[model samples]
Target: MDANEDLSPRVMDANEDLSPRVGMEFDTLKDAWEFWLKFGRQMGFDARKHYINKNMNDEKITSKGFVCAKQGIRGPEKENMIRTRNQDDTRTNCPVKLYVSLVREIGKFKVIDFIEEHNHTLHLSETIYMMRSQRKISKVHARLIELASSSRIKPKATHKLMSREACGRTNLGFVELDQYNYLRTKQQKNLIYGQAICLLGYFQEQLTTNPSFQYAVQLDNVK
Candidate 1:
């Protein structure tokens, strides 16, 4: 058998079911990084940029990525509030990493390699809030909130429904309180803007249809 065939099986064994594959391509390094950042959050890890390759013009050409288990107090730390010599305060040394490269011919950045093994145990729940991306509301969730708001659902009720939905999903990594606040804030702004636009349109229609009617409003002056 040739060396290439022999090596292929070994590589497959190493990756196993956890084999990492290339994902979507992007036109810019910033876009690529943002995508991976969200992807990593979904996968229950924190993503970091290890390196960046740049051209003479200071343009990003390629990038390296790495992921580590969210760091926090270990099991032993939870048992004992006070620190001791035996309790290790250091973070886990997770080995998962990846490489991304820009294909100049295609004008896109692609994930080139991925090392999917981790050296430490990962938290099942708390990892969701470790990164900012994970805590933020998703576009789909935002749309759901908008729909609920349009239907005259109370913000608190909408929050409860969204929280229940999130709880049922194994992949979403968001805090219920945080998600509620985000949805509420967005809904308020959208409602205010929507009302203003509707009122403006009504006034314009009235003025256009009834030219003889003079509408006046008093304004409070403030320094």
Candidate 2:
């Protein structure tokens, strides 16, 4: 029950189908044990001090006090190279593996709470759609301005007089004409209108959980 002790046995029975190979070599139990001990020491886990001297008590994974080796299971790298590969594309394994990876990279306490908080709900598809749509709308707005300015054939006489006078005072009329020219482009106007509608929709979706309102539960508060 030592915290550092292999919890694989508790999690997996002797006759369990899943067999975890330590690394690239050593398929047998004795070899695997020796390799693990040696590797642990090399990676800075002292067997005599960690296991023997400390006389560490059984510490389950759920307990906040427990601490284990940062190195957890590696994916295909841990499998025996010589054995014919019977690769199982484990769907359940993905989240757990990600969780462990996050815990090791970040800290276990924060990650555990993050998982618990986000366990049941996280609208990934909706989030992605929102991001994509927002990008598309921004692109449309830029294109509209570019196209409108390009379509300007000639300037009005009044615009020329105003432009000359304004040039002495920082050319405000010329700048306004340039903007008007861009805004008059047919393609630009069309794109602007289209993007505006899309943006409205995205904002409507965001408004559901936008601080004051709540349509779905927010995961940010969990951590």
Candidate 3:
């Protein structure tokens, strides 16, 4: 009946639900936080704990907020320190956020506010897993890394194998550098353990040769 009404574009609230929305309820604060984290991962950003408000009477959680990891800039006092150190501060004061409050009647947490706008560039989907909070060495990945190292396979080769098994690098959830770091840490642990074992063996041999052989180990301040 009306040309303007007929020409109006269809609505797109689907994507809004894809992210967090106001009045969204969760059974627990953890659920809300995890949901927000999932939303951040999907949106190519990282999230951080923002604030928590508790009821003064019962000391129960009244509200909670999760914000973009890059939400705040370095303060003025830190400006000289940062410049003196010749290091860059990554914070941009991005406003992207999710906040929820406890609903007494429903006994759930409801999202009171949601902001999707970000002042900084979001991470690319392909390399999003490389984010510090996202990258982790799982048990399976650790076993594979150990097996590969034991078999004398290179770190890069092991990473490729993991990518192939997961069908893509994104699915693998860690970059090649992570694999190298993990190997380095494992090697350090092995070296320390080997040193302790060698010392123990030497002590055992001394005791066998002379039952009264006495030795004392003195540790430095670091220990």
lDDT of 1 by residue, 27-145 (tens): 77776666556556546566666666677786656565545533333576454643544553444656676667778788787878767766665445545454554455556666666
Highest TM-score: give the candidate number.
3
Which candidate order results from sorting by TM-score in descending order?
3, 1, 2
lDDT for residue 67 in candidate 1, whole number 0-100: 53
TM-scores of the candidates are 0.42, 0.15, 0.63
What's the alpha carbon RMSD for model 1?
Answer: 13.5
Q: Which predicted model would earn the best lDDT?
A: 3
lDDT of 3 by residue, 105-217 (tens): 88999988988889888889776776655666776677779998999999888899888876887777678998899999999989998998899889989989999998877
lDDT of 3 at 113: 91
- Report the lDDT of model 2 for residue 52: 12
Q: Higher-TM-score candidate among 1 and 2? A: 1
Model 1 clash pairs? none
201: Cα error in model 1, Å: 24
Writing each residue's lDDT as its tens digit, candidate 2 over 1-223 gives 2334321101113453232231232223234334333332222221111121111364323212111122233456444442346752212221211111112233232212111111122224223222111111123323434543466533354335443543431322123444355446755769977997797787778887685743443334645
Q: What lDDT would each prediction earn against the true structure?
A: 0.59, 0.32, 0.80
Candidate 3 lands at a TM-score of 0.63
- Which residue pairs in candidate 2 have backbone atoms (N, alpha carbon, C) closer than 3 angstroms, thus clashing? 1-58, 144-188, 148-182, 149-182
Which portions of model 2 show Cα errors greater than 4 Å?
1-155, 167-181, 184-190, 193-223
